[model samples]
Target chain A: MRITNFLFDKVGKWSKQFSNLPDRYIKRAMEQVYWRNPKGIQYKPNAVVKRKKYHFSVHRPWTGEFRQENSPGRLHPKVFVEPIKEWSFFRGDRVEILVGKDKGKQGIIKQIFQERNWVIVEGLNCKLKQIGDDKEFSGVYIQEEKPLLVTTDVKLVDPSDLTATTIEWRFTEDGDKVRVSTRTGRIIPIPASVEETIDYKTKATYLEQPKDTKADAVTEITFEPKLATFEMDIMEKMGIKDDRVPPKSFWY
Target chain B: MANLRVMCKLLKNLNISNVKAHSIPSDRRYKNWGAQEVKSGRSWKKEELRLKSNSDLHKYVLLKERNMLLTMEEEAKAQIQLFPSPERIDKVEDSMENLESVIRERNVAYHKLETGRTGERPYKMSKNAFGLRYRHEMSEYTMPKHMNKDWYEEFRSYKHDRYTEQFLLKYREKSYVSKRRQQIRDFNHVIHLLNRFPDMDMQALKEQYPNVDIEKAKASRKYGGHFAPK
Candidate 1:
């Protein structure tokens, strides 16, 4: 049993080494063989070949394993930008419809489909759809926002004057980049929540402030009763002597 | 008389040095009283915007916003008188977008200067179900992919089912048959050419159809045509 175990271990190690032959060494050996006989021995063309060289006329039976290389009318997948372009209009932004039957109508953007370049404007360009027969709410006609308008059909309304305006980018003297109105030259302030995330300078400036250390310094002053006499005189003239007290007509 | 009135109105408001206090009306503000006319300037190009100072850009943006508002107002008031131009809104929106993107570019540059890294969200290359790679912005998550129970379940769902494997097998078979048919067509065309042009360059024929053995094709009965001995 001991001899058999030893023989098995030796065979296993030999097999592992044989399997792990270096590919580089094998490649180098091939190169040596090619160098020894650069122009390898040529063979004479066989006069009566058993098999045909070209299979042009021969039709091979279809094997289910082989796939067709060219599927008829197979279209290449089209690559498109996900959001089309960087969208400037956001939900709730007041916009005026620029085209279609609802042209000149104003409404806030309700939903944005950036990929499709479509936007649904609230309370504008709506269509009426009759609800199907139902137990509680049958025959009701509901007004629904129409199919989304292409982003190009809507123009953003400036918050300052509730007007549509073109925007331009400009850097302030302090090196802050802000959106500016092209028409009025007004600096369009970013929304507070969005500004908080992007404006790191503001936070850094706050951090750099000197800590207050005048907690011990305290002062107090009292007003004399004479100072209150003018107020009392006015109240007396109006027939209300006690101004501090609530009037009978006063309801809490 | 309408032209004179419009000219006078424009002249009155044409203080270039000082920014206009009131918004311009979109209606016949630029038009002659009796005639329909299209009058507007082109959008501000990036190069033009870059040439101007920060104050100047601000003024331009403000001016555009005011013009858009006035145009909208005019359209609203003259609902029966005139039809609003459809492209006007698109042009204004486009100008605004270009302006904002330029501002964002500057912001990114400034952020890079102040900080070592860009302030924009980080994205990584991710493959979709179709094996096409796309840039996916990374989001903050409490747990890692392997550790997240929901993510693990979703990953398992992405595995190919038996039906999918069967479909793939059929698709592959179809592809192979189409490829074989194309090769056969090419081979037949080459043989027909050889039969007609017996003196055709053998090297050129080999080069044209690399897979088709020209020597073997010449020896074949098909290349000899009907007149040659079978």
Candidate 2:
């Protein structure tokens, strides 16, 4: 127990000194150390001490073992939170402002920040920004667009009549998923790169040529046969004499 | 001769009339009657509306109004009692809006044919509080901005005061500090990555972090470790 405590203290102090080191390097070092002295050390189990009505839980009891077996270090807070899904709107989609000062105004979506559910529409919401000193530039004011518009404040515009329309997910007769305008009941074409899966049902079917028919056509064509004495005649004209020798006869 | 006369009279009495049914269409709300007395079609397209006469358009409007009233009554009944899908109200409202817009378009077209002007609201160039110019729909009874005393007073109060300016200054300073801290963190992370991966793609790293000076990061002592300088 004294030797195990001493080893734990030494490793703990060394690890504490290099706490700021990158995770991968520390993990590599720990793996090497673990393999070098596999049976020399053991991890101390977590202890729960209870008093009256209170409970105290202690983890990583000086044996230099991680709290979680597989995980090398502490888990990040972000890992516990699920990431936000992507919004429906994309850059270059025509949208109408639903509320605020620019209500009923239509513009193309210039940018989208899915993380914050914010979008920037081109030439829709504008604000005045004070630029330069009033004394130096004589009250130079530049009209700038607002940083972002909330995603909920904008609605997609139907391309048919350029009016605000709600979208509904629907399946086509060919079993392909498509977006349909709730107002007009018209199918809205899926924008490129937005939907990853290709609909094979919508693809045109080509008539395949019969394999037997192609083979029959090839067999129908006739080929002229070459004379077997043609090569010998050619060799004789070239003055190359053939020397005939029997088997098992020695010749230089 | 009497039997033939009686048969002809019976056939005449059994003759089917061509008069269409006047009953309202049955929907999912009606449990007993699933068959529709009258066939209902989709919303009127622009081309179809253009081909329709004024009287025809008016008749369509009346029919839509009746359907909308019936839907409203059904929705009210459903609201009083819990219904499985409350979205039926929204669907009814959307169809009503579409019908009304189609009617409005035909009305505008008819008015334009009679008069030399479009029967739509006119827009005027207006400026907001930020002094940004925009086209605003003109109101029927709105006074001029300069003439309205209440509006002028409100506009005067809308300007940023001294406290607002101070708050903005402090907010900008806080945002700048946060941005600077983010940059420092990114730089340190890049340095750590370089120390761990000596053969890492330099170009990709540079592209990923444009703000960090790659040369400066390479020259830093923290990235050099315990090795002597060559």
Candidate 3:
């Protein structure tokens, strides 16, 4: 009711909004409960028993730098934050990173940040080169390749929720895949069947692992058996020649 | 409860309720805003709603809850009547849409009287539109205990007579006129749009138009719904 003027001042469209309210609904609400000083409680003479109508403003708990703070840019891709903790049931789970220099690198996201958007991985092979004037050079003008953020170096770990929440768990261990509650850190486990197959070592359960898998098979071979196999494209039956891909993709 | 369920059904039909606004107290999937198991007693200050039977307190809470619903609905209606431009109206529409969600929670909680309430409901101790943050309808403030010489001295030093009311008035006067001016402009726009586009989809128009009532606009003298007789 008080903001009617504030609403009205923003006239263009909001003006129409308030004008349409039924007068009946817009009427000032009557105070249902009335507080009165009883005759017995009345002061004998100049004793002032005051009633202060206390009021306060409710501010949002969060105040931080937001992407939405400056402009109404196109919506960013939906960020899914999966936890990688000390005792996770799943293994070698990968999360798509969306921010920073090594963004879009599908490293198996190792850890999550509740307060910030920092994450850690086994090792990221990155190269950073310094570019500037050679006037104040110590030895010679040259660019240095360096790893920007290491396991020790703090990287920006983005969170899905703008208003940071704790975590929520569905169930206890070995139940559902545990997920942090939106704000609170209560674990919500995803239901897992007892019949679910366990991966021992580098057990390749191929759900169409691409060329990336070819490299992985040699480097990180495990003892576990391939749980399931499928020949999606029976190249032999189709009589199609599996030609070599461009060397630029795998090599230089 | 039945009425609220019907409202939910309506929202369901509208394809608006992507998130469930109502949930049972025991339901784990939805983190209800501590609605069920409302510990009734006094208004944060333990004198008003306390010392009474549970039924009286229920009645009190219900009345306040209903007023909140009324305000939301009124605001929604006014938004359409005042802001007719698509973009500005879109802003109002977006806000109204969110308000609908807030209403869903309120409506569900109000209806689920038997379920009881838990935790703090939707309200926060909010400041009014004015730059001041005043404690609102639902606040959890208790008078300080252990009345000592310090309490008497501190409280007695400063007078607090009608500060909240005084604060409210100052803001009201400041915001009052411009709001009315906005209302007039919107009403005119609604009148113009209807006169221009008579066969408009009334409901869609209602959703998009804030300042003008499509039906009323058509019925106005300038826009007399003029067309060939059917």
- Superior candidate under lDDT, 2 versus 3: 2
DockQ of each: 0.01, 0.01, 0.02
Tell me the TM-score of each prediction against the true structure: 0.26, 0.26, 0.20
- Residue B2 in candidate 2, Cα distance off native in Å: 70
lDDT for each residue of candidate 3 in A95-166, tens digit (9 for 90 to 100): 334445656454543332221123344344344445564777744344322222222233222134323233
Sorted into a CAPRI-style docking class, model 2 comes out as incorrect
- On TM-score, the stronger of 1 and 3 is 1
DockQ of candidate model 1? 0.01
Worst 10 residues of 3 chain B by lDDT: B6-15
Candidate 3 lDDT tens digits, B1-230: 22121111101111112323344256553222323221111011122112222222122323333343345445546654321111222222333444444334443544455355522334544433333543333422233334345544532322334775686677577578767776665566666655554554456455444555656665667665557989
Better of 1 and 2 by DockQ: 1
True contacts kept of each: 0.00, 0.00, 0.00
Compose the digit string of candidate 2's lDDT tens values, residues A189-215: 655423211111111221212111121
DockQ of 2: 0.01
Look at candidate 2 and tell me the lDDT of residue A136.
Answer: 60
Check candidate 2 and list the clashing pairs: none
User: Evaluated on chain B only, what are the TM-scores of all the candidate structures, in order?
Assistant: 0.42, 0.39, 0.28
- For candidate 1, write residues A199-246 as lDDT tens digits: 122222322111111111101111122222233434554577553864
Positional deviation of B99 in candidate 3, in angstroms?
A: 24
